[model samples]
Target: MPELKGVDGLSEPLLRLYSSLAGENPWVEFLTVLRRQLHASFATIILTPPTARTPAIVVTPGVPDFEIGAAVKHFSKDPFVGLPEGRVLTANEFVGREAYRQSCFYQQYVASYGIEDIMGLDLLAKSGFQMRMRICCGAGRSGFTEEDKQWLGYFVPHLRAALDLYERFEIEKGEENIYDTAVEQLSVGSILLDGSGAVIRCNLIARNLLEQRDGIRLVNNRLAFSDTANERSFRDFLRASGPALTSRISFMQAERHSGKPSLGIIARRLTMPPSLKLGFCPAIAVFITDPQQQAGVTGAAVANVLRLTPMEAEIAASLANGLSLLQISEVFGITQNTVRAHLRSVFSKVGVSRQSQLVQRVRTSVSGLIVQMSSGSGAPRRRSRQGAPLLHSAGAGQDRPQVKQTRRLSHVP
Candidate 1:
């Protein structure tokens, strides 16, 4: 890195350089200006090398991409590439001018376009980030001078920083999208509330639940329940000051239609570090679970981990959700004896001798956290021939067990 006399007249191009990170074509404006300032024929940059599914993204500012002929395309690798990092080297300087002129790579690819002089800046990051920029000129024009090299050299560090920041943001954004999609697949509605009880963030599931207005909704941007008593309790929870001594979990049911079950909500306060409390930090997170929509434990997921037949896996998953042996039989249209037989097999394979042990094992299994995305909402529910959810308790419409029977059936029986 060499020091310049001064960065006079660099404000405009430097501004464009950093600002380009947020633009659709990040390097177009800066590269276009670089070409103009240097009086070059073309300014090109390669961000991502070609892959099996995507062609290399090669950007040539002010130059429309047309066929450069088969000969040029066939010369895929640049012979003048691999220049010393951070050093601006022209093609003539990189290789002997005579050798550069005689090389088939230049004669076939570059000469066809009347390009005589070429200057390149390459960044090879240890983190596998690669960027290369080239400025080309015609034979009639003077080659890139020391001043031109120094000007580009000044931009090297800033270009690297801007590119690094851009890549970091893209990776984080991609991770966020993946997490949100997983939440949607699990069918859990999430809502975030700030310290003042204002809505900070709400996912699509939460939005749909609020839109229904069956039991709870957004009232002036704050959560509200249909029942006045329940509303007061929620308001109290929101207004409570100071952090809890220990992590705590609270549950509340928002009553829905007359015959329908209430929406189950689990509220937990988020404890932020003292340093992060300056901003509008989310103080509470509310998760809504609809048992009617709960298909989180799928048979395929269970079978993969438990190594059981699909039917046995389904029975295990049902029992894990607090289903009695009788209810499991009714759900699968199998006899109680057959259901108990499957339960015994599940216990044996799961290394559990008792029915309750098998239930707990399945409940805590990896399958419990997995969901089969069969349909739009990704919740694949089991329905009886009567078009009713087999897992739900009729009339009661609660998330509790369908029957009050004991979990254990003796092996002798």
Candidate 2:
């Protein structure tokens, strides 16, 4: 048999192992190499990203098969014995040494596996993240030498580069899958606008919500939000939320519905491909809420979002459609002061101060959701009319208030 030359010479064995480890995770190939080269009673490889403390094991192929690729989380937290200064551990340095002899938890396991020594090569990324890749040897009386250290030092860089490439590839793959899933699951109309505020990507929900507007369509590989006043504001918010800017901009409903607070949140960075960094002006991820999906929208579906007393939500819904306190009182058969008091409480509970404020707060709370109401259809569709002192209807039976239309954008991603 040809002698294995550290990691490089074991390529043939690794190819065979890769077939078995192949699954959702692609990091398994490197671990298979470590398993073949170590010739140990057991062996494994770990890859830990900077954002996480938990080390994800990529491969484990031998006697201690159960421990294969098991995440060595809480390694840093172990006060019993810090990792030895050197990469490799000889029988004397491990089984015969003070740290191993003194460690109650780790010693017994090493003995049971018949593992006499270990060599842990710290795989470091060009990104300056330290990763752990370890090999154990139980070959009787034979141990790792300085020659092995030199071989690992030469092989480490190649492993690091390969791992880095694989990770980036995996991230791109995962992001693509997630984006597709988001497109399928979300109910809110989403127009992925570019830096110029043109729509770059739109799903069925967005197409349905935006009424198939042409201005928002792609023109010469760019999307425009249909030069409207609201479109301008949406573009402005997107710019503020972009990575080039530092301002903490938020997206909220342009109008509030009755009894519900407008949904708004700060947009954060979305994951993108490395290719985009060179010249790709990526679209920002902004959330829009759909009121119909809200928990407090007067029905069981919205009971949670509004967090209102059932009676209070009813009153607020009445007030939202430009209803006067007297009209509401007549309809509910309550006094005007009592209705006003309830309105005040409704505003406070829903995080609004006045009727106009209440309406403003919920406009962005739910997207593509016109309050499931018939009364607002006749009221002049006044887009800019800020405040209309609610007029009371003459008869109690005829007093129905218009419904508020709040926009909701959900973060399905």
Candidate 3:
């Protein structure tokens, strides 16, 4: 391995590649820039290991899609695959010029693409994963020189480091996606705003509420209440909740839409370490709650809390939604008589006489249970009334007498 010399000219392009890798630039653009720097007709980086089912990543610029497809189809037979790991080799090293011109790989794949000679550097191989870089020249052009190979060799370590950094960045982005999804499922709408009151991040629920434009909306990327006075006050509250301040403010904004309750907005300044504050983190978090929005109750809560069977829980959940016995039977594909029987059993267990009483009881008891269940076990599995069998314990005979008094019922008469 010769010392890489006269490489000062390559510094700018190399730095651009590193910066692009650090940001959100596409890999193909980086490869295109790299190919121009190498003065090659085409450039590619491949990660293919013997034990791997497929290539992990393939970046090729200035290569036709058909040629790439053909290359993939015949990759096992390519002479480059036989090269020693982490070594630089030219096409002529594997075959003489005459033999190369007569080879099947050259005629079927390389020739069709007008590629005559290839110079490849096997940059790294670890745990059965090999990473390689290749530069190719067109037909009738001179092959890659020893200087070119040495120049690429010098940058192999930096390329490996950049790739490792990219992988870590991808992992962190995936974790951020998980966090965003979890927050979106929250019952309360959450919005993160900068010091200037511009929205930095918001969950799906917040987006939906903004779309409704009933009480609040996004104006010029900032949260705005329907009322001008409320909007002005909200903006001032956000400005006060800056990084230098630790304050909490709560306000109620009346809904412009009829029959909807006013929304409760709570803004709290986020406390962060000095280092984190320097990273442009949001200064305030706003939680919005709409009292008119119906709360979701999972059937699993009814089963676990009320000690009902899965089928009974399904019927009880439907009843809690103010569904008529006939409607519940239609929805579950069961007879109305069967629905009535299930309803009677549910009323006995829940200590509720009238349908309204049952609905109120279930709603009040299970409203807060959704947050706990979603946070702990996620949404409950919905059971099919037709497919799920009614479960009865042998001890039911003893517990039936105390069914109405077993649990302290809520909103039951």
- Report the lDDT tens digits of candidate 1 across residue range 207-296: 998988888999899898998878888887876666552145568888886547788887767666678665786767788877678645
Ranking by lDDT: 1, 3, 2
> Residue 5 in model 3: shift from native, Å?
9.8
Q: List residue ranges in candidate 1 displaced over 4 A.
A: 1-8, 12-45, 48-75, 95-117, 136-141, 193-197, 219-222, 241-250, 270-284, 296-413
- Model 1 misses residue 208 by how many Å? 2.3
Q: TM-scores of the models, in the given order?
A: 0.58, 0.40, 0.57
Count of clashing residue pairs in every prediction: 0, 30, 0
For candidate 3, lDDT tens digit of each residue in 1-413?
A: 22323433456546656776545443555566667766678777765433444454466754444444555566655665556755677887766777877877776667776776888767543323356677787766777777777766666777777656654454344334333433443346778876667788887777888888888888899887888788878767765634345645556664666557788777766655667655666766777777766645445556655667777878887877667888889988999999888889998999999888887877665544433322323222222234321111112222111111111111100
Top candidate, metric TM-score: 1
- Evaluated against the true structure, the overall lDDT of model 3 is 0.61
Candidate 3: residue pairs that collide:
none
lDDT scores for all predictions? 0.65, 0.45, 0.61
How many residue pairs clash in model 2? 30
Model 1 clashing residue pairs (backbone): none
User: Could you tell me the lDDT of residue 186 within candidate 3?
Assistant: 34
Give the winner by TM-score: 1 or 2: 1
